[model samples]
Target chain A: MNNVNLNEDQQDCLQEIINVAMGQASDQLARYLDTFVYLKVPSIEQVSAQHLSDTLKYEAQSVAVVSQGFFGYEGIRGEALLMYQPKDSDRLADLLGYEPDELSVEEQIIDLSSILTTTFLNVFASQIDNQMSYSAPRLLFSSNADNNTSSQSSISEHIQHNSFNWDTALKVKISYQVTDYSFNCDMILLIPESAIINITSVIDRILEEY
Target chain B: MSANPFCTTIAEQLNTGILILDLDYNIVEWNRFFAIHAHKDAKEVIGKNVFTAFPELPQKWFERKLSSVIQLNTQSFCSWEQRHHLFELSHTRPITTDSHFMAQNCTFLPIETDKVISHICILIEDVTDVCHYQTKLNKVLDELAKANRIDGLTQVFNRKHWEECLDKEFSRARRYDHGLALIMFDLDHFKLLNDTYGHQCGDTVLIETAQKISSLLRLCDQFGRYGGEEFAAILPETDLIGAVDVAERICKEIEKLVIKFQDKDIRISTSVGVATINPNDKRYEDLISNADLALYEAKATGRNKVCSAKEIEYILEE
Candidate 1:
């Protein structure tokens, strides 16, 4: 619908908020691992789910995937994704004293990936929502799966067929390393087009509020 | 479907305790699991106040939470991971035409079974095994951390622990703008003693030396073996004059110790160097370097003496 466009100042403000959110996420992951975790803001762009999958192709094959949906007041919707290498998952399991292969997909909530994802997303969502003075983000769903062979095709197809209602978009991709472990992950944050416009207006309102 | 008998049979066969409470917080049903775990039969528990049957559950809070099931028409769940009840349980409440509660790993879930709206169910699961393992894990970690910080031979803090303590003390001194002093000492001709006797006798001498120095220092002081035949002490809130006095006392004590090894009366001596910290000094290395220079000065002038960094610096200037 091309509902609204984010100007330069709004874009910078959004990036700054995302930076703070990712920093909190990194701290939470570090605590879960009982070791220091590093996160960096690599690039921020506006793209569709199909393009996101395409851009992350090199990492998609070898990565452990975690995704979650966020809903705010007035039907504000967005998603967050974290992609980590299998080696990273194994290291995480080792830190938690679990055998890597013993972790079951159905019982995902008890695993290190889910525990960390839940905590990270909780911190990220709170930081963003509080800054915007929006309603607290409600967690719609969460899933962590290995997208090696069987799931990749289904995910790609789902992305291709789905029609998003978002009008303005903002995307941020971060690369991070964990200390004392040979593991890394790509943290991706996606805001729907309408939400981005809402955020820009919200920021202007905040400037006036202050 | 008349599945009550089957459900009762299954509940009786299970290992964990199960209880069903109505919206009024009265015991509607009790299973063999409860009879075995709680040592109370179903007949004695049924139709009684749930808290009265246990006497351990919070009477007021339990009633209030149970009342919410029918009023809110929603399921309430509590996990044992948050805090354990009288009996650890994972509890769940299910909202349905008839409400039921399930406990998982030490929880209590009570359900409402009203005809119009049964929206709450509770479930509780025992988590004694997980709790036990967690306690054991914590104890083992505490022991491991202690072992890592202690010296194997002397039963005192080792060099690694000493360094960590020094780092903390240095930061504290700088933060509070207070004075700290370090005393470094080495046994005179310790290699010769090891050669003359044996390694075991040398260890005994080191232990004895540590004990002597520890007895002479104040309770606020910390002492640790820095390396082979070498030891270091940290005296918080002590000035240079106080540190030198303590160092001199330690040196005299060591010189007086007589060790009987293989029927030979062996007299041992130690050279000590004392240095007061400058709060502005950023690196711990500087403190150690100053102490080492003072120790060398003590050895050069004559052994069995205490030297301060200021004296060593004056000598260097001369």
Candidate 2:
């Protein structure tokens, strides 16, 4: 199948599953921030690795990107990325109750990303009745040209440099907001083509049971 | 009254200190280890708010953490590196170091009863020794890295570090289309000076020269000892005219330098060569070589003078 397109009903099912996972992730964040966290409806699409940048585009000139991989049985595996503008790194560090230093600032960002990605990934795995193993989170720097022109190409170059290659990817974009601190983050989940077959089969079973 | 015998036994004997706090932040129960380390009796601490017992605690942060555990029913953790200690407890081993306080890693977990979160348990782990050793190792590594970049005698950057800096600045300048300048100079007849006044006087002269040149350069300028009796400076965003101006000032300043050794006043001078980054230069080393050629010209055409790379090239063509 050149294009793996889900029908309207299947798409609705996938979105509902993602909504539950996003709720758990936001609850974790709300507790830490002592504020309510709001998440937008996740949008899902199937695109090639070459078009992954288009599916996951943000307007920030400088961003801190963090990624972690999770594995499930029957050849099911995927990675999630949490990215946000680093302009508020200082304020976020203070809000997280961390000492003001370069290393501490970096660690706080990593901690935030880890908590979000791991919580959401685990909850999704549980809802699907799959046991998932997680890898340590890694931080990556995403920078645009100094002139802020042609950011799309720069982002593509960065993705290519990281050697992320797959025939297809299930791209999901979920935006989170904390109203108190005016904080915004983009959580992008990319499931490889090989894992989609397993996920859809599980969804089919759920449909049959219902 | 506690209802579970096994739970009480584990709490009393566990090495990790544990404290249970009610929703009002009052201490409900504590382990033996917690009581001992805190230097407080169980009878004295129970029913008292934790903030009252430990006034030094970060109340804002602590309250937020406790509220999170209670509201979200999830565990929260803080590393020793993030916050040294939630409670100011004395170090068990006094002889370890001068630090009187213990480093702790704390975890807060919700205690649920009948499907409702009743209390929050705080677990404290002492990591003083590990933290102290880590701090010592980082200090040693920083000192080693600093020593690597400095010349043994002059205390200025060594040749390796200076070249690295120049290469970095060169690329930045080329990328942004900015100007850069290099200055290469050596003492006048340094070999003869060592022969006449002995190597000891020569050492003093080199040390005094390094100090003189360093005081004249700005912090933005990268100054280093290129080799024995030879020095170089890299100036970013400076053109040939600006480089020449700096070279002339250094020449005049060094001409007046007086080195007093064993009741003898020694005088010395330096010949300086200047080169600015030009379109013809492919790399930073190209600038270095051009400046070196200019320095040779300054020495041949009467020492104790300043020469520019373009001037030397013009004279050679004549």
Candidate 3:
């Protein structure tokens, strides 16, 4: 809509940083789950909070999502999101020896997204030369929640209601596929205008050094 | 960080553990909950590294966790379902819990100083009750799943579940070119027995006959109650001859069954049919139909006998 918020050089730098961070995180997850993790080349965008749901790769399907808020060395803060499509959960639960039920499957996804979020952000923080601290991962949306529980009905409505004070954010998106398994998920980091403005200053410094 | 004295002391006195760790893993502040569990005073361990205060604490894992919390400025979590315990603290309630040590779920809350994180307040809550109930619930689920696959009277696999098992075994046998045999048997005079002595007596005869035949078959055999008075067993890796031998043994076992019910001995006999994967067998249903045809032949020719599909076909050729 508006001209690309990031200059060509700035976008390139962010992409390269995301690539390295994602690679390490994928390796760590491969070891954690003992399954091959195939990562896509990550993309970054600037979008308003209103259009966030539309921009997401997944449609309004009832997806399982885990959200964690991270604070950096400065005033930099953002929420990390992991949205998983509901596929092969029963098979994965059988593989993990968990009860192949809705609750158990949701718990499995939450535990995994925790490892993946921290590992990726830790590397991304080091790349940007900033320390990151986090809020505990929270189950924001669950396909299981609708049938089992009465509340938290829809994901887009959940995101819209929790839209941060700033309307715009720097959204980083990456998807991962578990090789030999039908499980896959998308990881998103949403930094509001204020926090990401602080982040861009750090990005600028990295680019200047280069 | 300034706090409400009322809330601060309340947290200090609460049952759950409340401790604040600096970026270096040093304990900045703690409450009586930690003091009581670790058997240490706040004055002694508050300034020391948490791992140093308790040598048994998993330092490497905790250090990595604290690092992620510090660097990512994010909180992580663990559950008893995952790793069980992070701190080895004992609870006062021994009678309630089966475990000696307490099961704890921890929360690492970042204490921000003008938007920058300086300390992590770790809240430890005892989840022994939840964990125990969850474990109990899981056990019940396992039992329910087992019950769903079994016949209520006979305690053998139900027809639907047995069909599923047969389908899987069919694919497996086809893939590996392995032998598979099906046995279908029916009580010769089941309707007369049920009508003469009531359904209760008939149920007893079925249960006893199922158990007897189950004991005679190999462990790999998949036994199920196919119909009201009919039962089926799938013997993987068993050829036609092996299946016939098993059928004869089962027929003899059922013939000798004298089920005791209401101070009376009820005698019952069964006719068995055997079929193995032949060149003509295409699908699992084909094998089942062949076995059923052999069962019809066994009942028609002579009750309390074992019949094979190949031999019945030989008689047809004559």
Q: Best-fitting candidate, measured by DockQ?
A: 3
Tens digits of per-residue lDDT for model 1 on B2-112?
268887677778766666666566777666655555656666777887667778675544454354334323233333333344442222222421212222343233343
- DockQ scores for all predicted structures: 0.03, 0.11, 0.14
How well is each residue in A62-130 modelled by candidate 3, as lDDT tens digits? 577888888879777889899876763546654333445523566667656776787788778888887
Q: What is the per-residue lDDT of model 1 for residues A46-108, given as tens digits with 9 covering 90 to 100?
A: 776566546555455455555555555443456666666555554554654445454343222
Computed on C-alpha atoms, the DockQ of candidate 2 is: 0.11
What ranges in model 1 sit over 4 Å off?
A1-210, B1-14, B58-85, B88-105, B110-124, B260-265
Best by TM-score: 2
Pairwise DockQ winner, candidates 2 and 3: 3
Whole-model Cα lDDT of every candidate shown, in order: 0.64, 0.79, 0.78
Which whole-number lDDT from 0 to 100 does residue B185 have in model 2? Answer: 83
lDDT of 2: 0.79
Q: Cα RMSD to native, each candidate?
A: 16.6, 7.6, 9.5
Per-residue error for A54 in candidate 3, Å, reads 19
Say which candidate scores most in lDDT: 2
**Which 10 consecutive residues of model 1 chain B have the lowest summed lDDT?**
B92-101
Better of 1 and 3 by lDDT: 3
Model 3: per-residue Cα lDDT at residue B306: 89
Q: Which rank order by DockQ, best down to worst?
A: 3, 2, 1
